[model samples]
Target: MTNATTDAMTDATADAPLGRSAVFTILTTGYTGSTGPGVAATVSYVHDGDRHVIVDPGMVASRDRILGPLAELGLGPDDITDVVLSHHHPDNTMNVGLFGRARVHDHKAIYENDQWTDRDAEGHELTPSLRLIRTPGHSREDITLLAGTTEGTIAFVGDLWWRPNGPVDDPVSPDRVTLRTSRLRVLAAADVIVPGHGGPFKADETAPV
Candidate 1:
């Protein structure tokens, strides 16, 4: 990545709230692919009231990189009250042990452990402002979080769409049909999408210019 891109990633990272909650995305070089433009995964956090909810914390090695941005904003692991994994992938859910003070959440099918929360099959209402969405495809337990923001709805979807090497393509997942169904469901309501292996982009701007 260029210096400009790196700087943009840091500058645009944590420090503000998207809606009434403190939400931001942190990109780490934990898993960059050869053909991937910026194979960095996005680890997002939403501070709803006193609850600090982290979405897809990325690999275990990315803990510091993830915490660096949080520290800059005067936050830390103790501040994290919840950890929501979009799926059980190592890159997305490996750092669950880092947050001892937080509760882990994932799809019921993937998380049968007593420590982790596997809510209703239809998904759970995290808060009045935040809701969990089941968007299985990449994995049977894949999920997405919809945060009601002042700008509109922002969907934190893990691997719902990928732009390998900067080219937006229908990235391969476990099931194409289910992926398409999830995409359509999210597109119908999401204004912005925070993808797994890329940066954030406006949903409407995803169309060909």
Candidate 2:
């Protein structure tokens, strides 16, 4: 089950005036197996005005898992304007080439074609309703994408918590303490969370602290 956390970032969208709506859909729900090699990245689609964003289009059972959902939403790869990678792990980046025409956003900067423009990710606004914030933990370069959707703020956090029923202590995090701190920060800002390897869930008391 999912949980609900306090809303500590209502002001984040104060500047996002009315009528500007950002909507999102979970294209694929990822999973990790206890044995064997089964795994996939949870992928998401976000639309804010003219921007069509694909988040974490990583390893899937098949590319159709990502594309089929987009097609159902009336969008194609060429229609995607941006792609956001929460971190650089192959599971979170392997399918990046699918959107060759889109600009890519990582923890560091925006990349498009052959140009890699470097910039800090903290509070970087992709649109008036979506932004990026540094939340390094599972990896020193990890970042979270915060989207102000009609349902409230949703955070696409990579590996911070693999799922709602989290691996309370991240097994691969370089700094457990830092991961916990980042978790708290994300819990504060997000009303809903789309974890790296699972379906989206509400942020609440059950969140790892």
> Per-residue lDDT for 101-144 in model 1, tens only?
77777776334235544355244656666777678876788888
Alpha carbon lDDT at 130, candidate 2: 88
lDDT of 2 by residue, 101-208 (tens): 999999888999999999998888988888888888989999898888777788899888888788887778899877876787787677899999998888777776
lDDT of 1 at 189: 56
lDDT of candidates 1 onward, in order:
0.64, 0.84
Instruction: Evaluate model 2: give its TM-score.
Output: 0.90
TM-score of each: 0.75, 0.90
lDDT against true structure, model 1: 0.64
**Clash count per candidate:** 1, 4
Clashing pairs in 1: 37-165
Off by over 4 Å in 1: 1-22, 25-31, 34-39, 60-62, 109-118, 164-172, 205-209
Native-referenced Cα lDDT, model 2: 0.84
Worst 10 residues of 2 by lDDT: 1-10
